[model samples]
Target chain A: MNPPILEIRHLDLQLGGFRLADFNLEVAGGECVALMGPSGCGKTTLLETICGLHRPAAGTIHLAGRDITHLPPGTRGIGLVPQDIALFPSLTVAEQLAFGPKLHRWPPGETRERVLSLAKALDLTSLLGRGLHGLSGGEARRVALGRALALRPRLLCLDEALSGLDETLHGEILAVIRDAIRREGVTALHVTHSSAEAAAIADRVVRMQARVPDAGERDLTANPPNGRWRHRSSGPPPGPEVGRC
Target chain B: MPSSPPAPSHPWRTRPELPFLLFLAAVLLGYLGLLVALVAANILTVSPAQALEVLRNPDIIHSIRLTFFTCTATAALSVLIATPIGYLLSRFRFPGRMLIDTLLDIPILLPPLVIGLSLLILFNRITPSSCCLVLGGTLALATLVGWLAVLPRSAPPAPAILTTLGLVSLTLLATAWFTRHSTASLETLAGDRFGLPMTFQPLGIVLAQLPVAAAFAIRTLRTTFDQISPRYEAVALTLGCNRGQAFTRVVLPLAGRGVLAAGTLAWARALGEFGPVLVFAGATRGRTEVLATSVFLEINIGNLPGAAAISLMMILLAVAVLLLVRLFAGNPPPSGQ
Candidate 1:
């Protein structure tokens, strides 16, 4: 059997006073895991760490059975859709979608094809030439998603990418994301507060709990724990499930 | 029927802060009125015919050309240096970061005469080797601080390179310092070997203008970089862009207006600089004289009308450049977008 697509072992991260210690997780190929946690619980931090935006204090991160702990973000084969939907303001929808492939030195023909397909899939064909300034929240979110997915990354991490949408639009974009992920066959780690969002798209929901440190703990002085795994909220445990959405 | 709330009163008449607002407006208008009066005086002192005659003077034309050339060079050089320093200040948090930031303000805060005197002393009295030693020491210290800050998170190979660079800089600094006694002053060396003496030369005018102009540019760019969110660069990195690519592709496009603003403001400031050019470059007609020094020379020779005319020209030129920048750049893009 193939090893898991993404794995973390004994991960320790310290950001200011907040920390995530002794953290462990594994995601098989083409699986989507939803991480639900309260604010200041290191959910975004964990996502950033996995994407190589932050270095771990102590741990190993393996992507497709290759050690990527010390790799730079550009070479990590990870894609991130940040909480703010950080679309490049200077770029048009088409340019934003093509950004990743262009940076990786893709041939113009293939890059154009990838951009056209992603724009079609994400319903951004009409808005491809429009700059980000005029994009609605939903449109911007789709652009961000398309930009990330354009590279066909091994792991896609979304931090609150679907917040602030009305119910109907939320459901529509959720379906779009689900379809895109399935089409690309990419592993995903999604951070969101909405359980309904988790239930609708994620194959497994993992709730993160804040773990306050004891006063005399040695690690507490160095790096206090902010959050740890509480339980699997739903879905089958550990192994990859067949036919995941 | 429910009782209606009290009807709103006239905003200007009923607002409690009206008096304070009026006072603020009065102060603002008073200052503006003073500036208007000064410009009027300069204009009224010189007729168009006299101003045209002064403008046609061969020496004055030379000053105009020299002023434009030197100020443009100063502003361009200012922006080039400020971009990297401003970005570093905005994005990183190394030891002595605050110190370095505060030190950058010294050029702007110091009296212009002092800057000129300092430059004069530096070029004329200090040996080239001693100057090199000082420059190298500062560079080595900065590199050491930066390397130490990144050591914890950087890859092993990067730290090795930084360490080696720091060591090399330090060694060069020590060697220069040991050999300082045998070296000639920078001014003498330039005059003897290169025929490019800095003091009392056209090059000295740019040197005098550079420090203050670059300081202002740095401040402008640092504020601009601060306003932009770092998340754009972070996302770019994850999308397969190295740090340099992320900065060029993501941050620079967003900072286009700020760069323009910094360059224009620096040029205007350089054009208006007077004391430093006077003290360092010596205002020789057709040689080291710039527009700012032209005004001083006109006054010294009792050409009051010529002085007024030149002053008005300077004011008009500065205003036109500023207006052009504002019209072209418009307002900065909304931060939210």
Candidate 2:
């Protein structure tokens, strides 16, 4: 049997005062997992660590049976739609969609085809020529999703990518994302605060509990093991657990 | 009948903070009035015809040309050097990072005469061969530090180690050759090799203007990068762009206005540079003289009118350039139809 598309074991990370400890997760090929937790529970930090923006304090991340714990983000074959919908302000909708393929050096014809198809899929064909400055919230979110999916990454991570949308737009975007994930045949790890959204899209929902650090863990927070800044937890660390929806 | 209600006090009179607010306004306007008065005095000191006559002088024309050339070169060089340094400072935190940042600000904070004196002393004390040796030694030290820093990281350490070793060896060999063969001051070498000596030369003017101007540019660029959300670059990285590609493709385009602002500010700073150029390049007519030194030289010759005329010209030129930059920055081209 093929190994899981992405596997994390004993993952530990600390950013500022927040920490994630002993976190473990697995997503099979073409599976979508929604990570639900309260605010400041290190959900976004987990996504960042997986995407190579931040290095893990300990543990390993495997993609397609290969250890990618130390690899750079570009070579990790992961795509991210950040919480802010970080669409490149300088790029038009078409350019945004084409960015990843161009960087990966796809031939012009194939790139154009992929862009056209993705624009059609995302309903961005009419807005392709438009810049990000004037894009509505929903439009910008679509652009961000399309840009991420354009590269056909092995793993796609979304950090609250569909939040703050009206019900109709939210449902529309959720459907678009689900279709794209199925058609593209990529695994996904989505961080969200809404259970409804998670249930509507995810194959399984994994709820995270805020883990209060014990006295022994308090020492680690005061003086971290590595050169990382001491994690001064205002409340508690998010200890993620695996559960079937 | 009930007594008529007392007339309401005027709002301005009833406000308790009115006097203090008026005082603040007075102070602000007084400062502005002083600047306006100074400019008016300079302008009224020279008749329009006299100012035009000053512009027609060959010496004055030479100074103007020299000023434009040197400041443009300085600003360009500043931007070139500042971009990478600024980016590194903005994006990374390494050991001694704070020290390096503070060191970068010395050029800006030091007295201009002190900077000039330091440069003069350095050029005089160091020969070309010795300079090469010092530079090579610095590179070797940097390579050692880089090797140590990267060794523990997950990155393939061998490639970085090998490349830096190769560069260090090459530099050491060059340094050895230079030490064995040549023993000439850098200024003399420059004069012979490029026909432009460092001391009392137009090139010296650029060197004098460079340090402070580059400091300003670095500050501007660093702030600009800080203001931009790093998530843009992070997103680019996830989309298959390596660090350099991410920076060039995402961060740079977003920093367009800030870059322009940096260059313009540096250019303006270089244009008004006086003490360093005067001390290092010397105010020689038809040679190293720039607008700032032209004003000085006119005053030295007891020509206050000519000095005021030149100062006025400088002010106008600086204003025009600033306005032009504002216009360009304010109306960025439509990103798309």
The best candidate by TM-score is 1
lDDT of 1 by residue, B3-63 (tens): 9987667666667978988999999999999999999999999999999999999999999
Model 1: residue A61 alpha-carbon error in angstroms = 0.9
Candidate 2 at residue B306, lDDT? 98
Model 2 lDDT tens row, B1-337: 9999886576655568689889999999999999899899998899988899998999999998999999999999999988988888888755346877999999988999998887787676678677667677765665567666655653342344446665975677597675667667777767888787898888999999999999999998887788778788889899888888888988898888878888988999999899999989999999999999999999999999999999998889889878966864565422221
Candidate 2: segments with Cα more than 4 A from true spot: A1-3, A14-19, A166-168, A216-245, B1-14, B132-181, B324-337
- Candidate 2's displacement at residue A160, Å, is 1.1
Candidate with maximal DockQ:
1
Q: Write the per-residue lDDT of candidate 1 for residues A5-85, one digit (tens) a residue.
A: 998888887665666778888888988888876676678888999999888888899999999998999899998998888
| Residue-level error in angstroms, candidate 1, position B22 | 2.3
Where does the lowest 10-residue lDDT sum fall in candidate 1 chain B? B328-337
The 10 consecutive residues of candidate 2 chain B with the worst lDDT sum are B328-337
